[model samples]
Target: MKKYLVQFKPFLIFIGTFFATYILLTLIYKSYLNHFESDDVDEITRIVGYNVDLLLHAFNSDVFIQKSVSNPWLEVWYNNDYVIRIVEGCNAVSVIILFISFVIAFSRKFKTTFLFILSGTLFIYILNIVRIALLAILLFRYPEKVHLFHGVLFPLMIYGVVFALWVFWVNKFSKYAK
Candidate 1:
């Protein structure tokens, strides 16, 4: 048992650190969210919706997002048609949290880790907004394939990027690399 434990020490440490960071950040985010009324969207989600609206407009699409009166989501309207709801999950904070957790688990130098986390988080956030905007436009054009685009393709894209970032970190910057 001791031999096995010694052999797996690094892996165990990586797993422990990853979960600790993920849980801590998720709890903090949930607590922040708890401050909002049930009928009101959290600030992060609202900002995501707003950014999606801005991106859509940049593409010359008739787009606007408004808080839904009946639910804690933003209604995204494209070309005067109700297209999709920008819910909290659509905000991608959870994905960012996961990304940060993995990066921290394999962390190296403080400056490098900090810069990577900051840049990675920003990149994920921007990509999420672009994903939402593109999704809204695509949904408007191909309402028939909502499941494929939203459920599979977009998720694959975001998670794929995060996975790539994790791989890059491990090979290029992590302590494990040394």
Candidate 2:
């Protein structure tokens, strides 16, 4: 048992750090929500949703978008029609948490890891907002392909970016890479 434990120490450490970071972050986010009266989307999520609405409107001025962030829910209006409501799940916070965890697990130098995590998080955040905006547009334009676009393609796009980042880290930046 001791010998096997020694052999798998690095793997164990990675698993432990990943879970700890993910769980701790989740708890803190939840705790932050406790301060709010309404059970709407958290502040960060609201900002993301708002950004999505703005971006969509910018691309298509005729879309006539409005954000109704009454509580935690953010409803995007398309020409007075409530086209989409962004919930917590759409924020991509969970995805960022998972990305951070994996990067930390295979961390390199402190500065390198910190910068990578920061930049990667930002990239993911921007990509997610864009994803939401594009999704709204695509859904509006092609209501028939909701399942293909939202259920399949969008998820693959996000996950694909994360996977590529992981591969880059493992090959270029991670300690194991050297």
Candidate 3:
């Protein structure tokens, strides 16, 4: 028993830490998401995007305007200046995942582990951005599908990326491997 425990101690520590960090991140992420649901963060992102667009249009004279909708994410507009967009989505969670994955991958001391993790994180972030953009567009394009898009397909896609990344680490760089 003692011999087996010693053999697997490092793996156990790594898994324990990863799980703990994941849970803590999930909690913190939920809190941040909840805050945005309140309208403050949502409005701020929209206004910032709009203001930037306005400034761009001031010089270009191709400005546009936009407003928020029932979707509490962003308000975008485009015109002479440019286009302003408010983007909010797994932003906090994505940040949390990126940092966590980087740390864990670096811990493994593999030459390409961090790079793989970085690639995975970037992929997830891009996917998330597209997810939000698509959701907003879908809301405009097919109002009836909003429920299916937001409640089902959206989560399915993002979590699918996450799960893929998980498998990547386990199969390619797991500490448990002999």
Candidate 4:
């Protein structure tokens, strides 16, 4: 029993740390969301939707126009014909939290881990905004392939980025790296 415990200690620690960090951050986010007015939607999600709407509007003023985002929900209309609704899961905070948890599990030096988490989180956030904007544009252009694009491709793209970041960190900065 003692030998088995010793052999699995590292794996156990990693799992523990990952869950602890993930849970703590999730709770904090929930607390933050509690301050928002909407019962169905959170403020961070609304901000993400707002930013996506703003970016799409800026890119093509005449084509991709924002219909309404004053409330918690975001609705962006394309060519005054089709509308794309930005929802909570599209916000990408969950992905960031997952990324952070993994990074923490394989942490390096304190300063390095902190900075990497910050930069990585920012990168993911920006990517998510662009992703939402591009997805809206794609849906506008190819309305027929909505499920293929939204349900399959976009999720793969976002998760792929997260995986790439984790790979890079493990190889370049993690203490356990060979």
Judging by lDDT against the true structure, name the best candidate. 1
Local accuracy of candidate 1 as per-residue lDDT tens digits, 1-178 = 9999999999999999999999999999999999999899999998999889888888788987999988999999999889999998999999999999999999989999999999999999999999999899899999999999999999999999999999999999999886
* Model 1, runs deviating above 4 Å: none
What's the true lDDT of residue 17 in model 3? 76
Alpha-carbon RMSD to native, per candidate: 0.7, 2.0, 6.8, 2.4
Residue 7 in candidate 2, Cα distance off native in Å = 1.2
What global local distance difference test value does model 4 have? 0.83
Off by over 4 Å in 2: 63-71
lDDT of 4 by residue, 1-178 (tens): 9999899999999999999999999998878877866635676776786777678778764444332446555666767865577666678888999999999999979999999999999999999999888877788789998899888998999999999999999999998888
Off by over 4 Å in 4: 38-41, 63-72
RMSD of 3: 6.8
Q: If the candidates were sorted by their lDDT against the true structure, best first, what order would they fall in?
A: 1, 4, 2, 3
User: Best by TM-score, which number?
Assistant: 1
Candidate 3 residue pairs in backbone clash: 57-81, 61-80, 62-79, 62-80, 62-81, 63-79, 63-80, 63-81, 64-78, 64-79
Candidate models: Cα lDDT each:
0.95, 0.82, 0.58, 0.83
Which regions of candidate 3 are displaced past 4 Å?
1-11, 23-73, 76-89, 92-107
Better of 3 and 4 by TM-score: 4
Tell me model 1's lDDT, rounded to 2 decimals.
0.95
lDDT of 2 by residue, 14-58 (tens): 899889988998888778877766654567777886688678767
Candidate 3 lDDT, tens digit per residue, 1-178?
9999899987777767777767777787667567655644554345444544555455563434454555444454333222224555435345546446535732565556667666776776566656655555555557678669888998888877677677666666766333
